[model samples]
Target: MIGAVIGDVTGSSYEFDNNTEDYDLDLFREGTTFTDDTVCTIAVADAILHHKSYESALLEWCGRYPGRGYGGRFQMWLTSAVHRPYGSYGNGSAMRVSPVGWAFEDLEITLAEAERTALPTHNHPEGIKGAQVVAEAIYRLWRGEWDKIQELLISSYGVDYERQLPGVGVFDETCQGCVPLSLLILTKSTDFEDSIRSAIHYGGDSDTLAAIVGSMAEAYFGVPDTLAERALSYLPQDMREIYEEFRDRFIPTSSLEV
Candidate 1:
């Protein structure tokens, strides 16, 4: 979860202003800020902590952070009283699903929770699949099954990492388009920050791409203490508190300290 927030903040500045293949870019700049990615991630963690409905948690967070730059349909759902799903197949589901992977003990339960978390807004099959794939990847990562990660992703989702990435400035919002690229970036990375840099280099929905990659990277490589501390500084006090609580409850004590 902290990994996801770090990616969101680090890539926030690149989401709109620039689109370059510069993997050497700074991790954070003056414009960096937490976006919907971090908010929804914390919301999911809160839901898991309290055993509350994902819909309620998501709505509450979205309402509280109305300026987080959510997608158009989700923004509507956040403001609406009914709060019904709009059948989106966007990457929003995958971007916020890392906590679901960490909260559950078994793979089946993790997959179910991932789907449940997505259904509140991204009810479309692709959206649900995206969340499940990312959550499962995180699960496998936590289990130290790095050898089987790419095989599972390809066999399950047909993500062809061999295909060359699109031009650096390209942008895509669909789950199919972004999730595979994020996973591919993770596969090619040497560390957590490298994974984020690789994802941002592709330049499509930079924050979301890096968030998904960072979530998986954290499970595999663990976050560096200095990097984690710098990332936390960008978050508000309330979000930092939530992140610390979530870390205490879900993450293993030996993994990474908040």
Candidate 2:
């Protein structure tokens, strides 16, 4: 979960930037901070930790943190009293789904919970699939089944791993536009930080892409202490508490790396 937060913070400054050509860019600086991605991820973790409904948690968290770059439709959903799914197929579902991967041990349960997380706002088929695939990928990596992710994507989602990346600055917010690219970046990353850098280098919807890929990378390559500590510093006290609690409850001791 911290991995996802780290990715969000690191990529926050370059969401739609098309001029950056340096993959070795400084990760954090002025203007770098957590966005809706981190808030929603923490909301998901809070829901799992406290046994609250996903919708309720999302409402509370999003209400607490307004104007954090929420998509137009989601922002409308936040203010409206309807409190229902909006049939969105945006990457928002995928960006906020890392907790589903960490909190469940069973693949079926994980997939089911992933669906539940998406259903509140992203009930469209592509939206649900985006959340499921990202959660499943992380869960599989958590279980040491990283080798199977490509096969799962190919067989189930028909993702062509060899497809070319979207051009820099080409923004596509839909699930179908970003999820496959995130998985492809994960496949090519050498470590946690590399996965983040790769996502930012690819450019479009940087924070969301990195959040999705970073969660999977965290399952595969535990975040470095420096990066983890730096990332945590960007979060507020409440978010940090939830992150620490989730880390204690679901994160495995064996995955820690020096």
Candidate 3:
């Protein structure tokens, strides 16, 4: 998705040593490239192309990507070439989750796919829950159900969301900790840049966190025509095509403000 790509590209520079508050399009322009976040998600997308079932899909995805910065348990599965579940709640789920929200037409189907897709790597409750929240939120936001989405986020996650988010640090990458916060990041913004700034302002797990936030934000915010054109110019032909296609696919059917 463009959200993840733009975030990944935009936030790539700050990955090594920077606070979330330091945000700018200049950062994105400075040598951004796709990392494991996009690669593994590509594998996930690849797997889905092969089969509809989660087990089969993940197995295929694992084979294709073969472990690029995968977590402990996932690495084991990749190297061993076997199906396994770690029951983790890592932020990796959130970064790769945009597809689940965009791929299915039905909300329940989207959430179902989210849970199903999550099971192989993050079968734990927190993991599944995190993916479900992101996929579902994007669905509603795309449908112009802003208030419903906002209500669901507050009721399901916690109160003082805006306040709680900035406190969650870069090390707080767990699904239980990061996903709702990621939701808050997407909810708090008015546009693509502001959405990304919200992630940086929150100041934790920033690049990946921002990537997750950035991808979904782009989905709803609908990148500015000029920015999108310039950003596209920076990408390679193949990836640029993929980005453009995904932008259309993930773009919400309705326009709404969060």
Candidate 4:
């Protein structure tokens, strides 16, 4: 989705440089490439198209992009043929969960699909919890449940985010680091640019953080025309086309719409 893609491009330049107080000038300039966000989104899309099951999509994503810079725990999940949901609670699942919100027709479907997709690899409660929370947030927005978005996101993520994170956090970018923090960025953000920047400004695990924030921004804010266009310019030519196709396929028009 545009959310994850924009986050990938914007945060790509800031991953190794960890200065929350210092924001980069050209960090989101132009021509930034998609990393794990776009790749994993594509893999997930392949699975969704190939099979009706969200679990199928999760497995497909794991296999399609083995070297997608997945966390060590997820890499383990990706490599195994005979695998169970190894119970990884990584933010990787969160970073790539935006599509569930867009693809499904209602809130229940979003939650179920996100959970199903998350559990195959990230069956750990925290992992499934993060995906369910974000997907429900998206579904609420999609269904015009704005009054409930904040309430659900907070309760589900187990954070009382009175305000989006005040500044960058230093702990590992695990669910503890990424989930609530990304929610904070999304909460405070007013638009596509602000949302991605807010997430990137936090520094650690900037890419994943940005990806999560960006997805929510798209789900709620519906993405800006300019921002969406710029996000696409960053991908490789081949990938740009694929990204466009996937977006056109899954986003914009809902499956329930004529």
TM-score for all models, in order of appearance:
0.95, 0.96, 0.80, 0.83
Q: What's the lDDT for residue 58 in model 3?
A: 50
**Residue range 1-258, candidate 4, lDDT tens digits:** 677788877887677676657544465644356677677766555555556565565556556545655677666666677767787777877777777777777677778888876777778888888887777776666566767866775676556554433345453455655777777667777766787877777777777788888877777677666677777776657556656666777676542122
Candidates, ranked, lDDT? 2, 1, 4, 3
Clashing residue pairs found in predicted model 2: none
Tens digits of lDDT, candidate 3, 115-189: 877887788887888888877877776666767767877776677655544364556768767777777777778
List the lowest-lDDT window of 10 residues for candidate 4. 162-171
**Candidate 1 to truth, TM:** 0.95
| Best candidate, lDDT | 2
Give Cα distance to truth, residue 181, candidate 3, Å: 1.3
Residue 230 of model 4: what lDDT?
Answer: 75
**After superposing candidate 3, which stretches have Cα over 4 Å from the reference?**
19-21, 29-31, 48-68, 160-169, 225-258
Q: Over the stretch 173-231, how does candidate 2's per-residue lDDT look in tens digits?
A: 98877888888888899989999999998888998888888988999898899998998
Rate residue 131 of model 2 by lDDT.
95
Worst 10 residues of 1 by lDDT: 159-168
Off by over 4 Å in 2: 159-165
**What's the number of clashes in each of the models?**
0, 0, 6, 1
Lowest-scoring 10 consecutive residues by lDDT in candidate 3? 249-258
| Tens digit of per-residue lDDT, candidate 1, span 66-178 | 89989999988888878799999999999999998788899999999999999999999989999999999998898898987888668766655445344466777878777
Give candidate 3's TM-score.
0.80
Q: Say which prediction, candidate 1 or candidate 4, comes out ahead on lDDT.
A: 1
Global lDDT of model 4: 0.69
